[model samples]
Target: MLPRRSRLTGASSSDRGLPNATVARLPLYLRALTQLRSQGSQTCSSDQLAESTGVSSANVRKDLSHLGSHGTRGVGYDVDHLRAEIAQAIGQTQDWNVVLVGAGNLGTALAAYPGFTSRGSRIVAVVDADPARVGEQVGDLSIESIDQLETIITERSVSIAIVATPGQAAQDVADQLVGAGVTSILNLAPVALRVPEGVDVRQVDVAAELQILAYHEQRKGHPREEAEVSR
Candidate 1:
């Protein structure tokens, strides 16, 4: 286990000065490092890691530098050491309890996602109102009834909740989660949720990206013609 102080150190306000974009890319770097580690690579150069993660070598070096200089001048970074440092920096070294509400298809997929387990986040409970699906198995855990949410959350101390129901139920579920003491939420439904002060809510719309892509495609095919000259 990593020391509590070390876990808190990397997330200090000073470190948050790093650009949000860079912070978002940390997971990609960490995933690449995990893959390399699993393959028995003990050491790796920035170029090698860049090839695997598709990040530029310069960018990789710059991102790693933010967490402090962990690479050697001639030999590149030590894989295990870098992995531990990155994991700790991302708060993955400590366990985080999460709850998943609305066990529909997308919810099921999230419940079975292996990425969360590898990181420190664990889905300790799955909640759904459908009685038919309540006892169903998702990955290693059994789906739980929604009525048990408060008890389960209190028992697990769930700080995060993932809302995966339809847009109509999104806000209701979010309200319930907030009521049950969740401070952070990852909302998959299309609806925007209103939470109290200090609570965090992040929405992930699956079709929004498609709409952006379609908009770009239309612009490409119907390019604005240059201004014509008169005569």
Candidate 2:
């Protein structure tokens, strides 16, 4: 059996609440540690970790401090220890069953995505509304009709659902996911959804990021003109 430390950092340190932002960074650290471990680097300085994770050295130290100081002043952090700590904290040590809805282009890409497999999330089911796609195979899982969502959720005890349908169908799919007992949703649709109080919804708007960048770029060349137009 793996050591208790390998179970998950957050589960072990449940008493000490971690900030959501810090929790989000744990994966970045974990990925960096994985690379370091592969390279046979047993220890790493905060600066090295920060460079790999695209975070600052101070912020890395601060984030690690939340899980208690596992680093030495001169020797840096032990790779194995840091990986276990982060795995435990983010609950990645345990497998998470996930369901993907809408086997369209985006949904198919998500179903084929390798990121979730390496992390803790496993796509146990792929759901779609089209009858023709219902029995099709995606990755290792077969595409099932959305009609089977509730049954599949109950059977697999899936807690997370990924909505990859069209913008018009996003809300409807989300509603059905909620009704089927999925508490967390990662929405790839272009539209915002209204979920219940307990349901957690995370939107991934790929175009919005580009749009924001474009808005800033437009202002950079014509700041006065843009400001006057706004005024």
Model 2 clash pairs are: 8-88, 9-88, 9-89, 10-88, 10-89
Off by over 4 Å in 1: 1-19, 223-231
lDDT of 2 at 11: 44
TM-score of 2: 0.87
Give the TM-scores of the predictions, in the order they appear: 0.82, 0.87
**Local distance difference test values of all predictions, in order:** 0.84, 0.87
Query: Cα miss at 176, model 2 (Å)?
Result: 1.5
Instruction: Compose the digit string of candidate 2's lDDT tens values, residues 37-127.
Output: 9999999999999999899988899888777744888999999988887887788888899999989988898899999878889999999
The pairs that clash in candidate 1 are: none
Q: How would you encode candidate 1's per-residue C-alpha lDDT over 74-192 as one tens digit per residue?
A: 89998888888778777788889999998999999999999898877999999998989988999988999999999999998899999999999888888888888999999999888
State how far residue 178 of model 2 sits from its true place (Å).
1.5
